[model samples]
Target: MSEPPRRNDDALTLLAVLTDDASRAQVATITGELGDRLLLATTIEEALAHAAREPIDLALVDVGIDGGAGLALVHHIPALRHDARVVAVAHRADLAHGADALAVGADALHLLPLAGDTVASTLAAARSRRLDARERHALAAALAAAHTTRRLYDRAMSALAAGEVSSAAGLFLEGLVAGGLAEGLALYTALGGAAVRVAAIGSLSAAPEEAAALEALARPGGIDGAYAPLRRDGSLVGALLVSGARATSTSILDLATLIATEYAAQRRARAAMTNIDDVGPALTTEEAFLAANEHEIARARRHCRRLTALVLRGCGESSALAVRRELRSSDLVARLGPDELVLLLPETDTLGAATCRRRLERRLRGLARDEGRGPLLVTSGAATFPHAGDSLAALLRAARARATAGAPYVALDRAVHALPLGELVPTLARGTLAHFPSVAPLDVPFPGLLALAEQLCVEAQRAGLATYLATDHPGRNLRAPARSLSARDARDAAPTPEAGQRDVRPDRRAASAQGSSVELRGVAHLAGCADLLVIVLRGEHASWAASGRLANDRFVGVHTHDPRLADLLAERLEEGHRRRNPESSP
Candidate 1:
């Protein structure tokens, strides 16, 4: 015989409040018809206490009990349990309080002479409300996940921009974890017809056949787990294997695609670094060091000798020469930049590399003292072949990553937060924006336009200027009035008899003074009051050029595609300020 179906642990629990014996019997009959587990409560306090202890899916309050005390308790049911749906019950004589009960908080009203059909319909409405609540919570959770993924993706891109591939991989893994994968994340690369696991969060205990299958699969698919292949220029570089249920989520798929694309880009960049020798023969070029260092690694591999790549920073030629005097002729030294150098030590393992690093640090310290220069900060990293890494790019990345994470041998105290606002803000601006009127890309999902508008106001405050954020987005959400246009609401913002100049004020009775902060439908209110104006235009909609005529003298047009909108606007205002004062330098 076939086994009976299993019951779901998530069955709904209902609370029924009825004082009279007949009323209690009727509620029991109704709950039995609905097929929900009923918890009987004789008083309001009893129902409330039960709700506080456990999740209450539905609450049925009898209004005839204790002279309408049950009607009043309906309001408190939802407060005790947000997801609980309440239905107020009233007898024929007490039906007057049905509407009032619903007005307070009840989801619906169930009148007396309750039949099986009426009870079924009322419970159905309660079920619908429960579904709506669940959907609302799900949407909120998805949005929060999207926001977290976006933040991590941005950080990973920043690391990739700096050519820190290993660091980027680490950041990408962090994003994956934040996106909900608990464990069993691994990155595997194909080397010499075999797949090798490069980085992993947990043990990659898959058998040889399973590993080979993972490497062979072109698309993301799995029976026991999932693996997304990382491809570069049509050729497979590696694959990212993830286990568990979260691996099948839309967010994980998106993250996997992003990582694969970035990996391809990084690989292409590494390939280009191999060709940079054609540009110049200068030893100071980092590309030159990277290009020439591979041969040294290959020779060491052939000879079965240890090859160490040491990355050095914050030292000069004299200091390098001092270290060179301490090295053998077999060791290869290449200057990467003014304050950077890559040293290839033949037959030297991690221990020998550490010894050399210590001697260099000591020599640099003495040199700093003799030259009266603040102690020469020497930050270094070492990666040895066939031990720390197998490939040139990998070895270089490992060493560079170490150098960044490790401390400067001499103190420099270059913390950005320690700087004064006057000095710090300009430095940040310089780092973030290379030129003025920077064109940034915008991405608006529904109410995103409003968020962008508010960001503009914040930027204006930072620049100490009264600003107006104008958008030609004709969507109803954009029709909010401008707030704090000037010191007086009468100036410029007051509705005038002039055509095309009348203030487009929001209904004051319907909106607060801060309503303008939420929306800026028209520019008529801030015509002359705002010193700087930021105009947001949708790429698919009417642009600033097509939006009637100019309302502000100093304005910058920003599209959703444009990034760093606030920075661009601030830069524009500074440029205008500089132009106004011919002798001032911005």
Candidate 2:
């Protein structure tokens, strides 16, 4: 039976790849039939180059046109040109003949010498009716992209509304990363009240001086107009500064600031309302495979199990550090922000993890000591793998939400509508966070750290660590925290985890406890245009307690009572829940 007709709403801009003059003319003739949507490419490379610059909704490749060059173009078109869909066009029904094109990457097949009218008609019909088997395909991709963006935005806002800063930051950063803007972007903001570069993606290795120049780009009324008005309730917060020339305009900065402000506001609102804890992220459960061969990718698959994801944002750094330190000291963790975090809960679904999140958040709020501003704010989202989706990118996108712009949202799942994802979409492999479970350590010790005369942990070099050791360590580390590393990047010295390949999940295996532990995490001098320590708890009681009081002059430390266990717990907490929700015990 012939396939049904393609639809009109498909809105695909077709790239017709053909070498034969007659075929090209025929397809050309029918271009108008499909809204003159065809863009002819005699060669594959030209088609790809065209696609890179503009949107090509669909690609039609002539299978017998050349030395598999047409087929090759089909494969590359879908990849390089994300918005471009692909299909194989040939004279016969022998799919085997078109198998190569299909094998590499072909979304649909078409028998050749078909009337140009017929081709256009088929594509048109496909676009209109979901019931037609031969319908060329649906606008699944566009819908998905839009949906993912929306879902991510909503969850982000939920996290933001809840005042989960880093979690919201993580959700937002994911957008920059997926949009391919990371490599050239810089995330600058007010950690508490002072301005600082919170996170950065991309390479500035050779352009340190150039990168340094953009630092001032976030200044108020100093050529950086975007950040000039980042005030909520008459208070100026920090700005998100971008590096490189692509987004170097005041407009871009304006857009960035708008996004950041919306995000910040949503976060503040979410936190004030919930007062109850929140939760989710990915999973981690391959204990056996991890134990057998930590680095053996294939083997780990067998030992892994199911896990969910919890993202917490908007609480900003101080609270996020406390939460991450608290959770990692006890459970699974991944740091998504100086203030945001993700939790990979093994053996639990998103809903289950959310339950735990609620309880935990409630307890955390209970622990809140009033500073008069309000209970710390936090927003959150949850997503699962395989069941939710097979691609890490897709899953994160689908279940996450951003509160920065578009319509306001409260939760992730609420923002997304998972309709049928029709054919023509990319193949997604089921990968696990198991490969890169936790973040690399941001575990930097204070320079020349020593026991001060006052018995506080102080920087031996400047006596600052000693003061910082007193419950508050302020003066942002001009350097990135030591634990600020990628997954594998963080585990250079980790013993092969006893987790299995199948056990690949987020923070499933907690460090074996040696004894009681305590953990503290926070940013310092956040008010008065400086960073502030939110919490300081850990096995190293004296150190953490001391750090809390030395705010702005010292870096906060979260520790437990047991030295070794304390170290393990404290260090682990820093990596949990995307480095947002830290915890400890004593």
Candidate 3:
């Protein structure tokens, strides 16, 4: 009843219960040839004890043992070891007991004197069956594990899509661990151009150089084991780093991409919500300011009079009161935000608006000095109608762009000398066009300039924007594309030909263009402007300008979305027009 040596899992163990010497020898020979461990049980009790304790793969029972009590042993042996294959052996005359063994739980019945080849084949077959069962069990376990992994991945994705970034990252890290990846995982989000660790799992610490390398991997390039970049709108916004073996696995890479995408989406959603919260309030309330501004703009447009808007930031209640005292009864003063105020000055041109702004600044400064507060800090920006914008929103945008505390306003003349027009135009256009609504002047040949101008003019006209084009060769510029103008004129036929036409008198042309409120002046000659091309566009929502003086066979100037710049340039061009024609209505 002593235990035998431990057997290999692949090798089989056989328990033989027999009374006959011949049957015992035959079983021994078969077990030896099969390379299986064989155990002998002289009594039925001994056989049952072996069955209970041993890892038996095949059990050979002598049906004639214990006065045929071995049949009961056959039934109980299988119950003890469910995986053990039981085969009953009996004499040819004891065929009745063998059949009874079959009726019970014995898998097969064999007769003695058992043939060597027949018993050998039976033992081999039983071993093969045992191997197959083991494989199936392993496969089943693997399938269950795979199912669990899939469930974890699905849950992580669901959480990520729901904006639960922290929960998602944790679940994803858990999934990696469950998949046998015992590694440190760290997720870093890009904040203000630097990698910030937002979510992480395990103890992942790196030196400065190692951290730098991880950040580098987050950029647009190859993904090393150190980190994987999370990109949004083709720009890397975050990185995921891993430490240890299996860090660069396919599952890890795929999860990194998914997590990056979801995290970026989450950030964008938050930013959008923040933007919604930060919207500038209209004087008192946004609605009130908008309503008042709209009414003033419509009245100004109807009467062909100028309207100016001033956005003042950092204007306290005292400064605002001082500002109101200086303003005329017709002028509007509204609280734009907690410390911001907007002024709507009716019938005021840019010069007049500037005069009013200076007066307010002086008054506010005097009040501040009297109150013992030094140098009243207020930023003011001005936008005038037909100059800054045609609509309230456009005017506000223009004024806000020019407003900055402690920053001196760069005049149009000074800005022109600051940088080369070719270099400066493109520099202004750098970044998203949606945020900075400026046209980036293309560096094209001299002939391409005319074509580019024509294209821009056509687009502006199609959008129903008030366009003003001032070129020395006004006739040649728009007349070259006569078909384009002809079609537009057919749709919007006015009695005064077109505003830029050379044959029409300047006064009549200016008056006629007032119907559309568009001023397209074709100055015959002007100092410096002989080679300069200026295109001004003003719309309800947005206004922008593109001006370039011909230099080195290309137009070099400024392209700006700032409505104030557009207004400034438009006024400059109008001044040239007035100088040339002494009778044109100003």
- Each candidate structure's TM-score, on Cα atoms with residue i matched to residue i, is 0.44, 0.24, 0.42
What lDDT would each prediction earn against the true structure? 0.54, 0.42, 0.63
Kindly report the root-mean-square deviation of model 3 from the true structure over all alpha carbons. Answer: 23.1
lDDT of 3 by residue, 435-537 (tens): 3334454455667756755565566556542444454454345334223434564566535332322222222212213322334565537544456666665
Candidate 2 lDDT tens digits, 1-586 = 0112343654445677766567677766666555546677776667767778766666778776655556677767777776555778776644554787777777667777656665676556545433342333345644555566566666555444333445555565455444434344445544334344434444421222122333356546543223233444555544554433333436434434544554444334333323313232222222321222221111112224334555666554345445654453213444444445555554443334444455445445544444344453555665655465444344445445521221132231122112111100000011111221121212223431222211222221121111111112334332122122111233332344332222222432222111112223432222221232222222111223211212334433322222222222233224332233334322
| 96-143 per-residue lDDT for model 1 (tens digits) | 777778788777777665666766676677677777778898898878
> How many clashing pairs per prediction, in order?
12, 187, 2
Q: How many clashes in candidate 2? A: 187
lDDT assessment of candidate 3: 0.63
lDDT of 1 at 62: 83
Ordered list by TM-score, greatest first: 1, 3, 2
TM-score of 1: 0.44
Question: Which of the numbered candidates is closest to the native, going by highest TM-score?
Answer: 1
